[model samples]
Each structure stands twice: as structure tokens, then as C-alpha cells.
Target: MTDDDRGTRRGEIGPTERLAMNRTGSFDWDLDTGTIDVDEAGLLVFGMGAGAFDGRPATLVQALAPEDRADLDAVIRHAIITGQTSYTAHFRVDMEDGTPQWTHVQARILRKPDGMAHRIVGIVRDTTAEVTHSDFVLELERRREVQTSIVERTTHALSRAVTVDDVTAALTGPGGLARLGADGLALGLVENGSLNLIALSGESLEILDDFRSRRLDRGLPLAEAVLSGRPRFVPAFPALGRDFPELAPYVARMRFRAACYLPLVAQARSLGGMALFYRGRTAFSADERNLALGLAAIVAQSLQRALLFDEERALATGLQETMLPRRIPEITGGEIAVRYHAAWSGRQVGGDWYDVIPLPRGRVGIVVGDVQGHDTHAAAIMGQLRIALRAYAGEGHAPSTVLARASRFLAELDTNRFATCTYAQVDLSGGTVRAVRAGHLDPLIRHTDGRVGRPKLRGGLPLGLATVFGEEEFPETRLDLVPGETLVLHTDGLVEQPGADIEAGLAALADAVRTGPPQAEALADHLSERLWERWGAEDDVALLVLRRSPDPGTPRAPRIHQYIHQADPQGLSDARAAVGQALRDWDMDDLADDAELLTGELLVNVLLHTEGGAVLTLEVLPEPVRRVRLSVQDRSSAWPRRRTPGEAATSGRGLLLLDALSSRWGVEPRGEGKAVWCEIGPVPTPAGAPST
Candidate 1:
């Protein structure tokens, strides 16, 4: 043939010759005639000599594999139908040896003037090598994606763990085996040179029970991995009978086909090892081995972190407990219960404390307080504050004086933290509470009748802050207990509900107390369960419940008592109702009006002139006179004197009215306070009252 007919310039290589050298050929397809014209090189891709191959399109279709036949034909049909400029398809052709060869067909559609396709023209190449290389690259990418996904999932699951048990549960809990793509798994933790199998998942791994605890020096594959800080992959694990005869019996009955043991190493130190078993896998590829190692690394990191966290928490909480009261001092005349809790959230150490101190004359000092933080520093400060406050109260200081000294003491500490506290001097015999606050919540009183009240105590700033603000004066509030009443004092942590109003927390606390059991210890537990347990408290809590001994009177001398606060306008009316009821209960309704009048007069006198509340007690004297004694006691030391005032004075009539309504009246000096008492009697008394 001439050089131009051979597709070449006069002096250069021909196009068809160059295409043949590159293993590429050209083709033309006629849509109307269903005919194909392939060059010699293209005939070679069809595995046939040009003389042996016909130019019919059916000839190429018959050569393609059954599954690829329709695809190759549909490529051109779709291009023509959709008006596409070109189309390319990769399909497998059946070679003479019955092997499949990947073929690439790329062609441009030629349309008539009206856009109806009539022909196609394209070059052909034998792309087996290219397609095989591309497949290898895609498989590599898929394996990489799988390995990365395994690592990400393992890391994500272990991130939330903060303890050794937490890490173990993450690795061996439900769905843990499936997440790791293992039919079974065994996890070990190194303890004192021995590996302890802390977790096991799936079946057929029960053989690991024999090695649940083995020394690192032991020749077992898992233990060796931990010692050497390497991985041991058993590709033909089922055939390990010759190498490990000890495992032969177990392997005979095992359901797994392959296994791998990976060392858990962190900071160049081996913490443990992990073993994964497969059901259908017979071997582990390099990529899979690396994936197993990566998972081990994640578990190692989490286990190490959790171990250190547990150690730190133990040390912290131990120190905290050491600083607290080892035991509460037993006291007579009343029962006292106290509870203390550390912050949850892994802190385990905080500044909350509760203390009971004995004072002179059968009185007890109770303190509940919280320092400003949730760590060792706050706990240290709390320790010092608690001891110092206890000493101050034990030395006969009043509640206000004790808290003021405590505030000053905390201000002098080495820390910059402040604290809030409530201190009270309780006298069970006198049924009195002289309480003071240093920026703490007011104490709650659960009365004998199951009603709860929050005493409105005056407060200064927090302990250290009080001195900083030049406000070290904590005013003491006097509260009357009336036998069988319970006094509750707690740190703010007990009532601090996140995102809720402090007032709402206080209301909930009141409701809990009103509904809880009446005993001191039971009520303390109830409050702890209701508030601290329910909240999973993020801050430390300290609670104290002190219930006075009951004073049930004899049948002949029935008595009733009530506390009246000057701020409680309703308390004044309630006090009057209680007194009348008591008198009637004693079958002396004849004296109810007079006893109530005396109670009102004396209670009004105390509420009006005193700085705090008063306690009123009415009891029948067992003497034959059938006399009813009414007494009003207040923390105020001022005794009432019978005073006469002008009719229009509108004041100073309390004592004068008490004198006119009662048979006799007197004033007695009590410890830290005074009592104004009166007696009401009857000449025409009922039944056994006066038999002559």
C-alpha cells in the first residue's frame, strides 16, 4: 500500500502502524446497517484475525460475556436516543481460554442533519492492564476506609469512659463484638505483672477462661504480646495444634477459625492485651492486622486514662473523708443525723461539711456549710473552717458570734475561696434554736404536726466575703422547736436545681420534709434520697437533721405548744386557735377564752417588742385549783412589766391586758432569754375539777 493509504506522511510512521504499536485500534459503526469495521489491532482485541472476523455488530456482541453483552449494545443505543455527544462503557469479553478480559468502548455519535443518529466512530484499546491496576487502587482505598472507620468507632466509644470498669464495658458490652467486627473478643488488664481477663465476648472463647489470669512471663501468645508490646496474628488458628498442644482440645470444639492478639501499649508501657476471634475468616491481611493494632491502641489509651482517673479519685475522696468528722458525737435529749456527699461528675472531692458540737448546759451546736469550689483546695479550706467553727461554738459563743468568728477565720485562710454556712445553738430541754447564717440557706422546721416552715433568718455575706465587705455581723434568729419538732440545715448543694429558681428548690425541699418520716435519722435519709440522690449532685452536699425528744404530757395535765413569728401574721392567728383547742381538749372549754387572751397578750408583747419569734405553752396544773398555766418565751431578755396607758395610746396594753385576764402572772429569767407566764383558773370547774 502507499504511505498515505497506510495512514502515514511520506517520510513519517503511519497512524495505523503507530496505533498498532500502542495496542490501540479504530472502529466505525453504522446504526442503520448494523455493521462494524475494525482495524487489524481492534480485531486483535476481539481475539480474532481480520480474515476470521465478520464486520457484523452481532459478531462483537457474541464475543462479549453473557452479562456484558446487553451493556455494550445499550451504551450506543442510549447515546443515540438521548442525543448524547459520546458514550463510554467498560465490559468483560469472553477470551478464547474462557477467561474474562475487561474491554473499554468509547465512541462519539454522528447524527444526520435532523439530529437522528446514523453512525459512530471511536478508537479501541485493550485496557485489561489499566482496569486491573484501577481495581487494585480501588481495593486499597476500600481497605483504608474500613481501617479508618474501625479506628474512629473505637475511639468514639472509649472517649466517654472515665474508669477501668467503664472502659471494659465499652469494649465488651452489648453489640461491642459486632462493632469490632469480631465474632468473639477477650480483654485483659495488667495487674502486678499478671494479665487479668476482665472481659470476654461471644462464644467459643470460653477456652480463655484457663488464661483469665496469666503471668507476662508465661509463654501463652496473649501474655507474650503484652510483654513484648507486639501483636500475634494466627492466620491458621485452627491448625495450631502442633505449635500449641495446650490449645488443641479447646480448638477442636471452638467455633472460631482465626484469632489475633494485640498488645495494649501506651507511653511505651504495656497496660494490657486484647484478643479478637473470627468465625469465617481464615487469615488476616496486613491492613486488617494494622486495624486490629489501631483498635488496641484506642483501648489502651482509654484504659490508661481510666486507671489514672480512678487512682486520682480514690486519693481525693480519701483525703476529703479524712478531713471530715470520723463520727458524730452521741447526744441525749434528742437525736441528730448528718449526711455528706461529694460532687458526682468524677470530682469526688468538694468543700461541703456538717458538724455537731456540744456546748455548755446540754446545748448542741450544729453547722452546715460549703466552701467555694469542687476540688481538693475547697475541701482543704472546708476542713479548716469546720474545725475552727466547732471550736468557737464549743467555747460558749452564741450562734451569731460563732459564725462571725468563722467568717473572720475563713477570711484569714491561705485560699481565696469563700464559704456559705448556717450555725445554730440548739437547747433540746428549752425547745429553742438560736441560729445565724453566713450567706447560707435558712433552716427549715418540720413541726410536731407534720407542717414545715422556713425560718426567715437574717444573714450576712458568705464567710470570707463577709470580712471582705466589712459586714461581719450575722444576726441570730430565735426559733422555738416545741418538742418533737425537727430542724433541718443543709448546704446549698442540696437545694440547687440546675436551671431552676432557687425559690423553687426551696419549695421542693419544704414539700419533701413535710412528707418525710418523723424520726431524725429516717428524715435525714429521706431528704438525702429526695434531693441529693435525685439530682446526682454536681456539687457537694452537707445535711443535718435534729429532732427533739417528744414531750407528751400526762392525761391530767395535757399541754399544747406553738411558735409565733413576728413576721408571720398567720402565726398569730394559728397560735390563738391552738391555745383554744388545747384548753378544750383538757375539757376546760370554760377557760379557753381566758387562756387564749393571755396567750395573745403575752405573744403579742414578745412579737411586738422582741427582735425574734416567741414560743407559747399552755398546760393544766394537776393541783385541785384546776388552773391553766400559759407561758410565752422569747430570746429577748427584757421582762414585761404591767404598764398602764391612756385609752387612746393604741399601744403598751399587752402586759396590762395579760394581768386583767389571768388569775396571776409572773416573769422568770431563763438561759439567754426570759419567760412571761400567767395562770387561768375556774371556780365552777367541771366534774373531777372541784368535788368539795
Candidate 2:
């Protein structure tokens, strides 16, 4: 039928009936006989006369080709005997021109109300073109699925890669080119007008060198193919014998006949190219080319990311080295070993640091501090605080005084940063340590006999708080160490970790000390190993170990005496008698005159200030230095202020005389009274026979 006649017939049919006929191609049939009553296209398709052949044993076998007649006859017989709804078969039909055409036929058995057998009404259509088209579409779909899988796998491989070498290796690896049915592959990087062999698969280095030595121009098959920013397929290398004679011999040896060159371009930068080689003269289809180019783009991006990450790692390494202390100081008499461990992984650099400062009066100050954050800023702040702590300790200040000055300096610092630190001064001769804590973890002191103690001291507020001065006290804690005793100072980063209690870390440290390594280096190594084992330290860890040596001489205690002044004459006599008693007790009677003069000035101050009763007190103690402290107690709470030479005050003259005669003097508030104290130095030995 004409196309317009078919369209008009389709339009005349009702929408629902037309849709049903189009789907099933149903038609009327004769009841009580197996015969088709009407089939619009049956005469043209079957080359049969257009008349009903009722009760004549009509069957589809008449229209079917001889080779399919048996199968169609069997299907129709089964449907007729069992009253089955339908039967289907594929058959070839002999048309009017004696041409055989493949057709798909479906028949249904219909029944009348009286249960009489009805004709088999069916539809048949020529299926040769449809079947061929279906097969072609399926083949296309299979190729599409293969290409999609290849692209997905290649993209995944590229994403996993983290460096240029990684990208090159992945691109040229067994799975990469082999997935595309390639026998060999080569990856090149563009450099100095030549393609350098960055990577290769299934090829020797010598072969690659020989291939690259041809010095092919940029517009040649390989370079031009990639430089065009498109994938190019070389069907056969033998066909290019005239154009590339040098490659012909090698191509024969390698048994490579075809190749595909894919460019690696990203962000408008042409980095390099990849070549896939095959054994036969096979050219990739359009889909294969697109897949290869897509994979190349992924490889390029992965390589760039890897290079950037490498650069960042190098920069971080340099920054970390510069932030840490270059060298530790050399201390005399005692060995000082310090260990600083930086975090090996992650983006942060530690701010933990330690310093061993030499203080005046033969004492060494030990400091361990941690800035709050872990970054470049924290490292910079640590450096500033370390230098400031050393400078403050060098000024002959006690541990508390040094911490106080450091706190003030850090608080007033323009950066307005904060840090936690512990400062201690060790007197090598006496094994006496004076320490101050500023919101820092308490250091552990392990005695020689396996006793561990954290000294009792009030922790000062951290620096940078506005009200820190009032809330925090740099209380000094003194520790007396015997031979083989060790003091461990560390930052919290060593002990504090996620998912673990801090007490566990402390217990671990204590157990480590109990294992017993007496040397400073040995002890430091032990502690460092143990800390690393348990805490898996996140921040940098800094440790300082100080051990005391055995004392060579016996301990000796000197006598200290103090006498305060009173208003009465009896008070003056009482002060003199107390001074005499102190010297006699310590067997230092030769300095009686010096003690008497010091007492006179102190007593006169009480007499001048008090109108009534005043008190005088004396204290004697054995503490190496024979200290004579005199306290003249009065009800007045006022302290004596220093007076300049021109500023005249008759009462302040006693302080001047007291300052001149005594070794040390100061005023401190006593219960209900203020005490002015003075101490006298020991008497000089005659000719230095053995200093008493």
C-alpha cells in the first residue's frame, strides 16, 4: 500500500481500536471452522486468494516456507486441540514474485457461545528488516557498555594515583592498555621539543630509546595526532613505510601494526601524550576514541594534584625544621639530654619546646612550654616565649619571679597569644629545685628509692588572661633530690590523647621510671619511647630529664638568729641578749659586735614609731648560712619606703643605717604587728684553714 493510503486508513480507525490492532493485529474469524475472515495485509504478505476457505482444513502451513512448515503446523495443531489462547512462530513466506521473506506469525483460537470451534484469527508481518536492525542496535549497545566500563575503570585508576609517576605507571600498566586490546603502550612527556619516555608497558627501555631517537617532528603522525587535541588511530604502520621508514623495521620486530595516540591535556595545558599499540591493523571506532580521550583527561588531572601535594609536603618540612631549636645548650656538672619529636603525619606542626637556661648563682633553669595551637603561628609563638623565658631567667630571678616576668611579657605581647609553661631552677650543689607552674602539667619527680611525687604548688593562670595577675600565683615548690633521683618535665601532648584517660598516661610514665635507668640519656630515651607507644602523640612532644649526682660532702646546718626591737630599755637589752644567745648557740661569738649594731638600728625604729609597748623576736635556724634575722614588730602596718638623698626624713635614717650594716633586710606583715627583719653574714675565717 501507498504510504498516504496507510496513513489515511490509520486515521479512520478509532483511537482505542487502532491502538489494539497495532499492538496485536486482531481480525474477525469464521465460527465452527478454522479460517481467517479478514486480514488487511494477509493477501499481500502470503500471496493467497482473498476469500474465506471455511471447513477446508485451512492452516498457516500453506503460506510458510517448506523449511518452517513443520514447526508452524505443530504450533497450530496444539492450539486447536487444547483450546489454547494463542501460538507464535517465526517462518519464511513465499511471496507472489517467488521471493522468500522471513515473517513472524501469531494465531489465536476463538470460540463461539455454543462451544463450537471458531477459526484461528492471526496476524503476520515481514520481520527481515526489523530483525536485522535489532541485531545492529544490540551490537552497538554492547560496544557502548564496554566503552563505559573501560572509562569507569580508567577514571578510578587515575583518581587513586597521587603523582606524575603514578599517573604514567597506571596509564601504561597491564590493565590500562590491555583493557583496550592493546599489546604495548608508551607514555611520553613533552620536553625541549622532544617526547621523553616517561613510562612504557610491554616494551624494553632500549626499544623505547630507539623509537624516540627518530626525532619525529611535532606535525608527524604521533606528535601531530596528540597535538591536535584529539584522539588519532593509525590503522597500519606498514602503510606508513614511506612516511616513517625508520619505524618500519622496529614495527616489524615488535609485531605492531596499529596505534592510537591520545593527548593528555588539562586546563588548556598540553602536558604529554599516551600511545596504545596493537598487533593487527585495527582502528578504534569513534566510541573507543572518545573513551580513551576521557581517560587521558582524568590521568592529567591526577598528575597535577600529585605534583601540588608533593610541593606542599616539602614546604611543610622546611617550615617545621626552621621552627624547632637548632641546638641544645651544654650544661656543666650534670648532663642535659633533650628530645623533641614532631608529628610524622598530618598537616600540623607541633609547638612543644624545651629550654635549659644557665642562671646566676650556679643554678640552671629548666623550662618546658606548649603553645595552645599546632600550626605556624603556634610555632612562632613558642620561639618568642622560649627566648623571653631564657632572658628573664638570666637576670638572677627566682623561679617564681622569672615566671611572673614571663607572664607579663607574654600577656603584653602584641600578638596577644597564650602558652602553658613550667619553670624550675636546679641548684647543682644542694640538689635543691625551685619551680613555678603556669597552667602546665605537673612534672613528676622520681626518687632514687622508687618513690614518685608531684610537688604541691598552686598553678598560676595561663598568660593572656586580663585578670591573671590576681587569680594566679607563681608559688615556688622546692624539691630535694638525692643521688640517682630524676625529674621529668614534659608537655601535655605526651600524656593526653583521644579515647584515653590522662591518668593512664601518668601511670604509664610512672611505670616507665620504675624500670630504672639512672643515666639522663637512658631515662630520656625510655620516656620518649614509652610516650610514643602509649599516647600515639598527635602534637610534638618535648622531654627534659635532670638527674642529681651523689653529694660528696656531709650535710652541715648553720645557725640563723633574728632579734626585733622594742620601745623600752629592757627591750634593747633583751635584743642584745637574744643576739648573744644566737652566736653562742652557733659557736660564732666573734661576730657579736656586728650583730649588736644591726639589732640597735632595728630596735630604734620600733622605739621611734611606738608610743607604748612593742615586741622583739629572734629566730635561729641551721641552714648552711648562719643567718641572724631581727624583726622589730610594731602595731603600725605602714612599710618603710625608700628615700632619695635630697628627700629628708628623720625616721627613714634608721632604714639607711640598717641597710648599711646588715647583709639583708626587709619588712613583712606579722599577725597584729609588722616585723622589720635583718640578717647578718657569717664571720670571715682567718687565713682560710677550713671554712666553718
TM-scores for candidates 1 onward, in order = 0.74, 0.49
Worst 10 residues of 2 by lDDT: 553-562
Residue-by-residue lDDT tens digits, candidate 2, 235-262: 8756655566655555555657777778
Q: TM-score of predicted model 2?
A: 0.49
Q: What's model 2's lDDT at 50? A: 50
Residue 313 error for model 2, in Å?
Answer: 3.7
Give the range where candidate 1 is weakest over 10 consecutive residues by summed lDDT: 683-692
lDDT of each: 0.81, 0.67
The numbered model that scores best in lDDT is 1
